[model samples]
Target: MALYITDECINCDVCEPECPNGAISQGEEYYRIDPNLCTECVGHFNTSQCVEVCPVDCILPDPDHRETKDQLQRKYLALSGQATAV
Candidate 1:
């Protein structure tokens, strides 16, 4: 599933740069995750880099953008300009 920044975020600025997909950005309040660009780090890392680096433990799965691992893999491939499986 895609991840999102919660209100618990301390605006630590650590999670933004750690996102390989460049999905995280500063919002009106805290950093926000763009589900369209988020691949849960599937193509880049074994785990979510933002979650690892976040100090406040505010990043959590986006229930609204729920996705399976295969879906995430497909997204990663697409974002990397690779062909995805049908």
Candidate 2:
């Protein structure tokens, strides 16, 4: 599944550089993750890097954009143009 940043985010900019997929970006007040670009770091890392770097623990699973492990890998590949979209 992809991740979402909560409103509680302190906008400390800690999680932006940790994202392997480049899904994280500066939002109006808090950081945001593009679901289409988020792969939960399945192909690049063992766990979500954003979550690990978030100081306020604002990053959480995006229930509305849930996808399987295989799907997440596919998303990563697709974003990088290494595989077809699933």
Candidate 3:
């Protein structure tokens, strides 16, 4: 599943740089995650980097964008411009 930043975000500027996909950005009120660019860190890390680094624990899975592991891997491949594994 893709992750999203909630209102609980403290704007500590911690999660933004930890995103390998460059999905996190400073929003008008707080930080935000671009769901399209978020693959739950599937191909890059074993766990979500942003969630690990977020002091406020404001990041959570986006219910509307739920995805399977294979789908996440595919998204990772697409974002990285790597050929999808067969």
Candidate 4:
């Protein structure tokens, strides 16, 4: 599933740099995650870097954009332009 930043985000600017795919960006109110670019870090790392570093614990999965691990892996592969065993 793609992750999103809630209103609780303090805009501490921590999560933006953590995203491997550059999915997170500054929004009008808070940081936003582009679902199209977000792969939850499947192809980049075992864990989502933004989630790991978020001190407010505001990053959460987007139910509306739910995707399986394989789907996420494929998305990551496409975004990264590299092949790897999932």
Q: Compare the candidates by lDDT and give the number of the best one.
A: 4
lDDT of 4 by residue, 1-86 (tens): 99999999999999999899999999999999999999999988999999999999999999989999999998988888886766
How close is each model in CA RMSD to the real structure? 1.3, 1.7, 1.5, 2.7
**Whole-structure CA lDDT of model 2:** 0.90
> Clash pairs of candidate 3?
none
The superposed Cα distance between candidate 2 and the true structure at residue 29, in angstroms, equals 1.4
Residue range 1-86, candidate 3, lDDT tens digits = 99999999889998988999999999999999999999999999999999999888889999999999999999999999996567
Candidate lDDT scores, in order, read 0.93, 0.90, 0.93, 0.94
**Model 4: lowest-lDDT 10 consecutive positions:** 77-86
Cα displacement (angstroms), candidate 1, residue 42, comes to: 0.3
lDDT of 3 at 1: 90
Range of the 10 consecutive residues with the lowest summed lDDT in candidate 2: 77-86
Candidate 2, TM-score vs. the true structure?
0.92
Q: TM-score, each model? A: 0.95, 0.92, 0.94, 0.93
Candidate 1 lowest-lDDT run of ten: 77-86
Candidates ranked, most accurate by lDDT first: 4, 3, 1, 2
